[model samples]
Target: MTPDAGSALAGLTGADSVAHWTQRYGHALMDTFGAPQRVLVRGEGPYVWDADGTRYLDLLGGIAVNSLGHAHPTLTAAISAQLGTLGHISNFFASPTQIALAERLLDLAGAPEGSRVFLTNSGTEANEAAFKMARRNTGLDESGNGVRRTRVLALEGGFHGRSMGALALTSKAAYREPFEPLPGGVEFLPFGDADALRAAFADGGGATVAAVVLEPIQGEAGVRPLPPGYLALARELTAAHGALLVLDEVQTGMGRTGTWLAHQHPHLGGGIVPDVVTLAKGLGGGFPVGAVVAYGERAATLLGRGQHGTTFGGNPVASAAALATIGVIDRDGLLAHVTDLGAWWRQQVAALGHPLVAEVRGEGLLIAVELTAPVAADVAARALAAGFVVNPCTPTTLRMAPPYVLTREQAATFTDFLAALPHDLGEATP
Candidate 1:
């Protein structure tokens, strides 16, 4: 199909589009998120054309899920070939791609020999599986106090996922309050605070805690990278106590942040290897897939054959997509490209000199701009009208996770537009 095939609604609709989505689809579909910024119709590379034919540079990369950019010939052909050959089969049976992807992920994370993997369909499911593995490994659950363990530790502003099991581990009140009566015994500590983290585990009866779950770099709350030595400290404390360290890499994994695993960074995450590593975004290069990479004894011993199962977890099509994505990332040397370009982009953005622009920070393609003014949502809208697309994480923060394949020219253009943001305010973006 031509790229135009994807723009089914472009040029043919406008005023009724938003209203139709609200009146017809809002009730029909779940209202988990509010109305979208625009009805995006089609995309190629960093450019997306909305229903109105307004082209936008997709700085969000579908929330860091599209690492190879959009519709690269290799990714498209790989998915098509796999779909044509063999799509999905029952989990009771396995395929080559499934096993290969799992092995590849372990190798990428630098897991020592004997590591294992569990596959899922979304980041939340991956975390759920990891949490379950932690519990099962402790030989508890399905029983009273002694049978089940309480006190799962999470970091403030850290987002793992949104399912019940994952939700219990998340510390956000807004995301957790509406759905109360959740599993209890979960504790929260300030993020990037080594002392607070040390204290939390210590207070949790330290050695008795089931596991410590946290994102190496908090993504959804606006690309918050952990301070240096924090992760290493977590590793040390978890070791001192016998608690499992679960690193939620759902956002920072799959080379979104320059390294295959953000934890490979020398300072923020560095060489510290957590007990459990969860990944999803950018795993399938825009397709739906998630995984938990557990090293050595932690992987295969999580559950027995009858303990867990999913209909589409290890399907061939998604696995093939993941394998292909990983292949493209490696063959193209995108990891180094990400690091160099990210540094350049961040440095250039910092030169904007807008007070609204307070700071620029992030690892690779995943970047966040803190503005002095609380007008992030407005700025995002303005950016869209200005023919670029960005996201407002907070009133004072702009989040940009453009694809790894982005060029220096694209980065320069973005810097210009960002510098003009203050002027665009009070007026329409264009």
Candidate 2:
């Protein structure tokens, strides 16, 4: 083999062989989502190894949760140290790390100068908390026919979570149809078109319009981003209608999109301040943590006593992990690193001249490569064969959410490999 062509072959992680683990170990596990792709045993930096000891470059970053990258020394140390100190206290009390992380998230979000935060275990719960807060703040009880709030407005193709309230906001029909009776009364507006949003809320007397929920940039729809004025328009319309704007930054928050919040992008920010912001994914930096931050009186008086609670939500270990990850990101300048690298990386991939590639989009460490043809699955298999990990958001769309820890050299190498994807897939070879 030529020196640059590749590495060794003994026990190498060829794609077909790695699938064998799904046969051996996966049988014992329940069939939640069919079978496992690979029995990932260890991870470090931007790579993961299967049970056969084959390592592949990881570009997904655990679906954008591993911000500092896998098994990062600082993140690991902080979690371990915190676990040794004070692991869990339930939601009945406050842990210093939890309080500090909440304060840090609110401070970074720049929520009208002063904001209150509600802690939860995951993004769904965080969103659930935000929903409860909005309902509480409305001060219109569901029973009284008092003010009769009719609906919440969510954009089409936007994804928040799988919970009943959040699912009601998600636009995908497949995820919602089966689970009907889902706390209805929400209007679905086509994304990216400000006119649609305006038209939807125009009829409602604004009394029934409780809140407007949307991602600053949509991530699940293969990282589809809104045009410059859409988010700003949503903010304006929501405010005009007396409806609160809820920004779902679960996947876009933290430094994933080069800024602490993706909505901070000038085109999107547009001097808009939201009432509720829900975050998860990158918040804990691979540890399980989620939060709902409420601004003004809307967040303060909502959900009074015994309204909602989570047991393992905001454990000290996860809080420490978030604190360590945030510090390292700021100190190491990873935010700027993601911005510069993200821009350059997308440009290089766009220049690949592959027939299969239709477009590439996203911000910072979150990105997606859209293929003209519906060959994303085959391309992913091919890329895995060549020793890189990627995901197919749709049959024609592939998403890459690499760690902010990815080096420039690594991004460049992936670009080169992506350029060859069309040829490999056409050959019907893996």
Candidate 3:
């Protein structure tokens, strides 16, 4: 539709206008996402306008993918300039932007000497690459004995991705059972249970384990951070047992958690180093890009020539977008802002004394409000009606990952909404 036509469509009654577009969406698009929340016409900074011309404070930040926020000038300019110069090139060839981005990621991740990066178009692809690295690293142990390390340990309530290989590593039964007989050898340990983790490694000294995949903060599982010392123990066990520690930072990397990587946070990560780390989501701001950062010589060389490849990955345009995003995050000092604002915001919400609020958890801007009851869906619906956008991440959790550009005043507006919420909002009707 033309810009003028879209504007005219919005002039209609809000319901009619939204219905028209949503009807078209249902007919044209796949049902994977169920229904369009709203026909978002455009966005700027942390706000978006729907087809009805109504505006909303985008608290979800495109599901934590919009690091620099919507319509960021720097990201746009970088992508445009790179596309004007060079866009896509075969894997046999490389561009300066691609090389620079890879180097930048390695540097930001503090990867040791001999570490390497494998770029991809999304988080799922990054995880898929890490899965391959884990499999390929199953070589002979000491004493020249071949050890078939086929088993990969993952945590319960973890989410890797939807692709075949990545999905195999994911633990949710609903996401796995439908596609039965998935790639085998993935075992799920009870989340945050040190005993369960220790017991798993007790047998065979983890000789059959190829890798232990974990999310420093489990985003999909209601923004739960790993308990203290859990990560350090994993690192020690994996190191002593000759297994790789693969961390999936797809939802927590690139300054989302006030640190470039969540596992780098002193309190959260305890200064432990992982063998492999997968990143995406905010890496390219709103643009699509992902990477597998393999640390040390052993993990870096896991996937050698001809073992893994992607045509559109590491293209000049995507690389430029990511570089520009990183540059803006550094130049604008968003990391410190997220850290400071997130702490204050949580305190503000907690002090409201809202009976519905059970807990406020998460680091940096990735926050979740755990409710005393299973009314997150209702609360999110009310939030939408009140010119805000939030996610019902679970039956009892409301998640918010607003842009780093969000100001204190804007955040206060949301707190005011919470203060004015009806006490009986979630009460069931007889």
Candidate 4:
């Protein structure tokens, strides 16, 4: 390394360390994310330390990415061992780890025979692959002469991803306005409105529909799950109309919702099977990996050879990291732990009777505390100052997705903070 770089690195622990790195971050990085929250140096389990050596409970889990928590021994060792053995062989070749992970995901999803998996490097890319799959399944005629379907339906408040195709499937106006003329034929339905969904599919509209993409739980829109029977209706309509049902489990999959996939939950998913399920976030625990699971022969063959591809996707190390994460979750029984702990924790927070808190909602550890006012940003700031990480996902919601390994004692600390929250905390809401 350069002498200047070495000197700057050595000063990371000095006084004014956060200020120094934050200033450097502004100059060296793009401002897409506004500003750095903290210069985190290291993490263990559910805790992380800033460059200044002040520790904080990581309740956000890297926006629901760090499933096994940071620097988990098993995840680390798996990545290291795989890298030592063989890291990247490109998509031109296959590895045992990649195959094993695909099999595991299919098994977890209860996929039918002839199902397949296409791996990617991020959630957005996984959705992109799913998008193409939807487009390809455009209801072919018996004679296979004319393309029949051309539209894809998504829900309002749904967040698929930011890339062009995935962004087209996302609903927020602010996210879509700037990128007008996106891949066309994506329509947004009112979230959880069975009437609107039915109307869209009525009057032969379903014939022109290619797919219905949805999130089991809308994470960015304040951790809202689809209203009961909504998913089942979608599945039924899609099946009747010959349209693909794609579930974007990027934020809700891989045990984040106390289940392998949120759609597997009886209450949330209504026991309906979707044709396509896209996954990422915690799939690799902390490593970068994503996947598109196409169920059945028809969906699996939508993307034939050369229809979709990636370079560093499904690399041995990433596959091993995902395998290790799945192993830990299964062996440790973190799914049941998350289900029980999340239910108990939400109840405890709600019982605190904090005036700012209007409601506590979500499944498993993926939670959102809705405020009576739009003071989520201010409350999140307070949480940071108090050595806890959280996300102001919306004006009135504080989202938390702590690691699965978090103990009740550690969770109680946050509840204690909530119980003692000041009444005037929202006075300076911005």
Candidate 5:
């Protein structure tokens, strides 16, 4: 065999297949996500198999992206049918599924009559579209001459995305400093701090701000939900100041929190709609699709004919996958299933009486177990060793976002493992 062909075959089959591939990965790929924990081979429902055929319950759900879990028949079938019929088309043209998905998103959003949709491939792209819309809503054309309003505001510890514009709205200094001089005029205030929000609007010089973006539930900040009336307060403040309110529902939307959108939850100020909403993550079940939905004429018309475009935004197969996902969620009653599972799981985890676990907080299947000690990384590692997959969002927060179709028995088994974490790690049992 040729040298390159021989090298490829060296890692294809072996008892140490994962090790060989991991070594190859470190050499071939960028060191962006650090070392991968395991080399996953395949998945079904909420379980995944490793290179060695070891199975794990995937509690993280691909960082909240896999709403219908792995290998969901409906999602897979929809994608296959659409790809077989019509794979993709350019933005210059539109497909039946594309228009249908847009209509379905508007219906799910419960948007007003003139609401509009802009589709993209991921959450960052969705946020970029929203940011551009916010800029345009200031009545300032692309020319630098007419600058009506330029400032954008976000919340502390809130994450929008990693792209330059979205990263500017993200509050993490480590994430922002590396990409210095980001799209400027973006400020962050303490999340859920009503006083801080009110004061910022008060000092905005009566319409110096273009938009205020926020996540109703902060996922990267350890599943932190907004305090009572906080979203309503934001709506009131932004409306009073004539600034747009952009809700980044990238992580919390798509029934992850047992609602079409977290902001629609009664506890989170139901019936209060924002000017713009960004959605991705679970929208396509495992297929990649993101969208920006604008409510009124003012917000919808911000981007004119040639302002923005996407090559693979509303591909027929991806749109079909999303439609199938939404249909399954509604047909299988996953909304109520996730609601009951979330409450029950939280109660069981908290009642485990483990000394390390301090509190459990979240909505629906999106949850975080705050540790009394900063042993979250340790716990996650231990859980993986015990055949479960979880995420350590922070040093003290263990985040869990399992599939909507996860059964009660699967949840019970995971909870039982969590209760035995300390003992499994060779520490004294609680």
Candidate 6:
């Protein structure tokens, strides 16, 4: 090897470690996510080690993707065994695991007998599929003639995804402005404002809208949940005008919020089902898999045979990984465990009397700490320095979506970690 290259390699294998890797990353990788917090090298249940061998509690859980935790034996075995048997196939063929995974998702969603599913590789693709389905289905009537219902409504502070179509549905301006001339026929409304939704329908001539998409709980927007009874009003409004109610449960489904779906939570007043639900994130437990589940006749039949397809959507390996994730969540009774642990963590964190902590809000493993000061980023940095990883969703909000396997001891340790932070957490970096 060349002299400089040899020295860099020696540094990577020696004390410099992630610093050298970080410098190389800045030169070679895109700046989409800015600098990564650390160069993670290894992980176990609720813990990850950086290149320096410093272990962290991993409370962010890969932004809610590691549902079963790092290097989970069940999940790894499922994926590996499936890969060995039949790795991948195009949409022209189907695998038993793929079909079973879809059936399982429908069962967990509590969908009716006629419900159907369309699988994708990520949450963005899942939202895109749902978006296309809404347009294709709502543009035609029972007899398949042309219709004027083409408009779509989404909530402010809602984050659907980052693809062109899903980006249009996402509410953040910064994420949208860079890619202007986005798909039209979409309207943004104040979240949880039932009056605004009703007025929009009335002003748009009632039947001009195709769908209303929403996140049961806004994950990227600091785990902000829908206000009480708001979803019920959304369901009623959409049903009355024949507009589809699409619930983007990408980050809240698959037992993340102590239930199969966050809408099924007792406080949300169960039984208010939506027409479409998009899921991903924790569904595959770190393996890439997404699904768009449609309930009832209208939404289920939206996309016919040839309307939408993906090459690697339901590959056997991904399906196996998802099935294993669901099985573990059920077999281990993680739903109830998450529910009780969330409550306990919230109570303990709030009782810390930390000046920076304003409040803790959210359900199950999806929790957020609203800061009294705009020091969320500083707090996150300090937390990381102390060997715990947390995410700052906004300048004033710190969010955590830890794995379901997280124990009470680990949860309690995080509380103590925060309690030990100094009153002033450096100046808030942008």
Among all candidates shown, the one with the greatest TM-score: 4
Clashing residue pairs, candidate 4? none
Residue pairs in collision within model 1 = 265-270, 356-371, 356-372
Model 6, residue pairs in steric clash: none
Q: What tens digits encode model 3's per-residue C-alpha lDDT throughout 1-430?
A: 5446655534456555777889978988999889988888778999998877899999999989999889999999999999999989877998898899999999999999999999999999999999998888685765657877888999999999999899999999899989988888899999999999998889685888899999999988899999999999999999998899999999999999999999999868977889999999999998999999999899998898999999899988999999999999999999999999999999999999998888999999999999888888888898999999999999999999998899889999998988887887667722
TM-score of each: 0.91, 0.91, 0.95, 0.97, 0.94, 0.94
Quote the lDDT for 204 in model 3.
87
Candidate 6 wrongly placed segments (more than 4 Å): 1-16, 142-147, 424-430
Q: Please write out the lDDT profile of model 2 over residues 304-405, one tens digit for every residue.
A: 778887888787887888889899999999999999999999998998888777898888878999987778888788788787888888888889998898
**What CA RMSD would you report for each candidate?**
3.9, 5.9, 2.4, 1.7, 3.2, 2.9
lDDT of each: 0.82, 0.80, 0.91, 0.92, 0.88, 0.88
TM-score sort, best first? 4, 3, 6, 5, 1, 2
Cand. 4 TM to true fold? 0.97
- TM-score, candidate 6, is 0.94
User: Which residue pairs clash in candidate 2?
Assistant: 150-208
Residue 218 error, candidate 3, Å: 0.7
Top lDDT hit: 4
Q: Across residues 31-145, which tens digit of lDDT does each residue of candidate 6 receive?
A: 9989878887778999998777688999999999999999999999999999999999888999999999999998888898789998899999999998997787465656877
Q: Give the lDDT of residue 352 in candidate 6.
A: 94
